[model samples]
Target: MTNFSHRRVKTGSDPRRLADYAALRNELAKLSHPARPDVNWQSVEKRCDALFEQNGVELQSAAWYTLARTHLAGLSGLNEGLSLLETLITHQWDALWPQPVAVRMEILCSLSQRMQQLLRTFSPSDSDYSALNLAEQQLTRLISALQRRELTPLSPLNALLSLIHHSAVRLEKSNSAAAPVVENDPEVVLTSTGISAAPSPETTRSANEVKWIYLVPPEPQLATNPQIPPPAAATLWQPFALGMLAMLVLGSVALWSWSLFQRPDPLQTPLASSLSALPSVLSPMQLETLRQQGPLSDALFTATQQQLTRLSQLPPDWATDYSRQLVKQAQLLWPEKSRQLTQQWQQQVNAAALPADTMNGWHQGMTELQTLADKLNALDEKRGRYLTVSELKSAVFSMMTHFRQTIPVEEQLRLIRQLPDDSPARQQQIEQAGQHLRAQAYALMKEKEKETTAASF
Candidate 1:
């Protein structure tokens, strides 16, 4: 029974040694790989030569290099040499593996001490920051080398590495714990097998297989039914809509240009008279368009302003009568109820008129129109009687007749000043106004009386 137990123990022990041997051989192959570009042979050789010459250890070039660094790290009172030892340990793990456990432990202890020592040497201005980074990289490599050789799987060495790793974890935990709680929700749960519930089927694929798994969903396949033709692709109607919008824009531009340039004949009596009279309450754009179309009309309107005076000068009944006459004329020329009447008038003028006579008449009509326009404007500006309800009807008709015409100021101003000042309530303010019909009438009456006295003399 004793012999069997001993045999069992030996069997268990044998495989562990074999495992160590196999792992070490693999690590050696990795360290010695020709393609392993990280290992620097010359610097390592130089370091080993210096150490071996001092220590009197006889070894081959590579073996001496490996053993020399391992000794430098394992020795006491060599604090500055730790960096050199760290580099050697990373590149020469194969050599270290053949050493006894005591030696390996001593080397690891030295490495850990060296790591702590390096933290103090961290200078922001140091050109050797890359070397330091390389040093850290080597430390990582050494730890991995140990693992490859089953060194980290052992109790004491494993515990030491774990202690270092855990310290880093604790430091990170302390910092994160100091932060205020940002998330009210817990982390997403994973399955028992470490998969998230919504784990991508492709996530488990090997690196080489990853390319085959598209992040985007695949296009859907059509049904295999023979009877149905494939549904027609949705037609893009954008071109048609754009074409229609373009046509509308062009039409509007053409209309605007025609209206702006078109002029009226001034010789035609009713048309000329209508053109002569315009309201003060026209919008600036509208007024500008009309002025461009018929410059003669504007001149006539100005002359009329110089002639006519305030409505208050007229008999109260006469003011109403004049308003009715103007309204009736406006309806005949530019009727609001029927646009056809205005169109018919235009057609008649086109049919009967000679081009030169029409042109000459238009010029004269525009001049008279401008005169009357100025008079109407002066009346409209005053605070006294000017337009009544009947006159407003007349003005609307005039605006429609001269659709090409614009109010002489801002559109908002024309709207605001639509009601004329010759109203009864506004009579008190009539004297403040200049060039009104009443004022003109009073002057005329005084002149007539003076003429009678002269004749008597």
Candidate 2:
């Protein structure tokens, strides 16, 4: 029932725009509420499908959609909700490797919250208990990974961990009470060493009644005479049978010993061959070289870029050495303009006053930068120093476009006007910085076009 007019979709198919994202969120919200009898879940699911199918879905929006769907599915009493959450966690865990610590932290916290909510809804006897237990363990492992990576745990993360711990305790208690009894004792006796007594009169009478019925058991019997012995041939066969039995026992032992001594066939010994074929560990130098090579395949590039984007969000001192290595790789890949582009990015990041509302846009900008870096690296691998000028221009244009979208001119001007009179000169300096970046981007595009023209000739 929420108004959709204010949530207008931006031009093009980008799902990150507030309007489209808000609409999806509103739909999911309505669908997730179990008490809303008027809501049509089927239509909402179709809408979710459509939204996900849209091009260039932003990470936050994608994450939100996935989570909302998970909740909606749970509300519908479908086990698939837990399955979906588990899949998301697995994918996100792998993706965390290339993400910045802050982003990773955020992702982990969000996943933890989802898991906590799902687990809270499950009874200990439900079929989903095993999955819940696994999720709880995974959350622990994730927290440990964060610690190992030295990412400081946020308040919400700590609270989520506490909630998970409490849920685990409740689950454990319920499971223990539900456990099957392993043994049964039928009789319990009381013993007193100081006193002994004869059986009661009733017990004696009952015992006599049981004995009296069998007291007449001795009955009359008939007798028969003795019989004659077997023939001499039967006696002779007994000795022969003993001799045959001895021979059979000796033969069986001999066969058993022979079989024991036999060697196994070489071709059938698959385990031995498999063990021999196992690869040896790489040397430290080799490992270092592999690390320096960076990501080669598209999947690797995507994962690496995601992680680098997250890393870029953290304080520079946190990942100083790793950042330097990545920068070196970027410089190598885009020898002409990586430094300049990075400087412009830093200026924009520095000038922007990012409130909570604009964080999505900021993250989108970072993702675009990562995409551009990945494209450059790919191009370098394919063409070496003789890059595709058109491709480079396109990548640069895409990055700038995303950056501009993230921090629009109107927002920038508004932020500038908010600056205090004491820092009047700072506003002008920042504005000039923005102008310089725009000029640089224009010049870069022109240069790439010129390069393309020359290459064609």
Candidate 3:
């Protein structure tokens, strides 16, 4: 634990004051990580704002940085986070508040990553262009900043920027491919290879086994009645009967195989059908011939992506009908998952047709509680014991207030009200926070007293 109290700032540019600045930065980093049920971003954002205004040169930037990130991670206020970071990097940061160049560089890199996601989810239409432009502009700014730093082409940040740039390029290429400029038609038409593509060894073996079963007649038993000498007419008729039987069997197998191909796909059936009426639309043999596929979520994403890619290529009027049919075909094994996924796809399609930004301006802007909590825990903790006892006290109180305020009052009551009265850890933390606050508080009081005593003498 750090002695986070009683710090003086900018007093003759002292070494200790500099250290306090370092410590304050670390504390802010910890408090702003994405939330658990224990962590609430909106509440923490308020705390950082309060500290940002009151802190000295060294600590102000840290508070600003953390608060910006908190907004980015919160479910609401995605714009607020993006705008703040934009301002932070757009200006010469050191001139504004002595924020280190390295810190600004780090912010720039992180911003580029978020922008890359926007490019990935961009719809292949004009409605998507404005948001993509925002992302592209920011990414361009980041690249410019790195260039200003004279970052090498091989630097890690450069590598990340390259990946981001590629997403945008890929999206643009896809749209271009969809609207080909070529005047000439292709000489060769690409028809479905169908099941005409060569079958696997297993499929070939199964087919051969079935064919041979009918084709090969059982061997004749050695005639115990050979002495009777079978009639010539009976032997001749026996060969003809056997040949006819084999022909009948072969015709029946051929009919069944033809019917299999002609069967209507369940995906093409009307929407009123129950998912559970059949164990699967595929037959036991067909299912057996094919290997099993996917965890439902992975399958849904894959299927949806492929369909959406084609859907995007169509004109909006055509896409409207196509999207409905495409989602129907994408129904997976589970009805519930299928329903939820297709509904979401429909919503996106509807939103895309309008000028509205459907994804809250980006694909992943919303942060759920559990996800936020996990992010909070996984973040790198800043390390260092700095800040004089008084400043440390102010800093500690800010952190304490952060811990105190983020949980809802009802949750707070439930968590603490019925717990054992003896909370050693809680008591110790309070004592520590109070120690920081009071020590700094007394320092000012004592300083005032010294002036009075001097005047009286």
Q: List, residue by residue over 9-41, the lDDT tens digit for candidate 2.
A: 111233445455566556646535877544444
Alpha-carbon deviation at 176 in model 2, angstroms = 2.9
User: How many angstroms is residue 276 displaced in model 1 relative to the true structure, after the best TM-score fit?
Assistant: 99
117-216 in candidate 3: lDDT tens per residue?
5334533352232333333454456457557767534254455447545654665666664553222111111222211111112111222221100011
Point out where model 3 deviates above 4 Å. 1-39, 51-90, 96-100, 103-129, 149-160, 163-457
The alpha-carbon lDDT assigned to residue 96 of candidate 1 equals 36
Better of 2 and 3 by TM-score: 2
Shift of residue 418 alpha carbon in model 1, Å: 99
Cα misplacement distance, residue 369 of candidate 3 (Å): 99
Off by over 4 Å in 1: 1-51, 54-98, 153-457
Q: Is candidate 2 or candidate 3 better by lDDT?
A: 2
Q: lDDT (0-100) at residue 298 of candidate 1?
A: 70
How far residue 410's Cα lies from its native spot in candidate 3, in Å, is 99
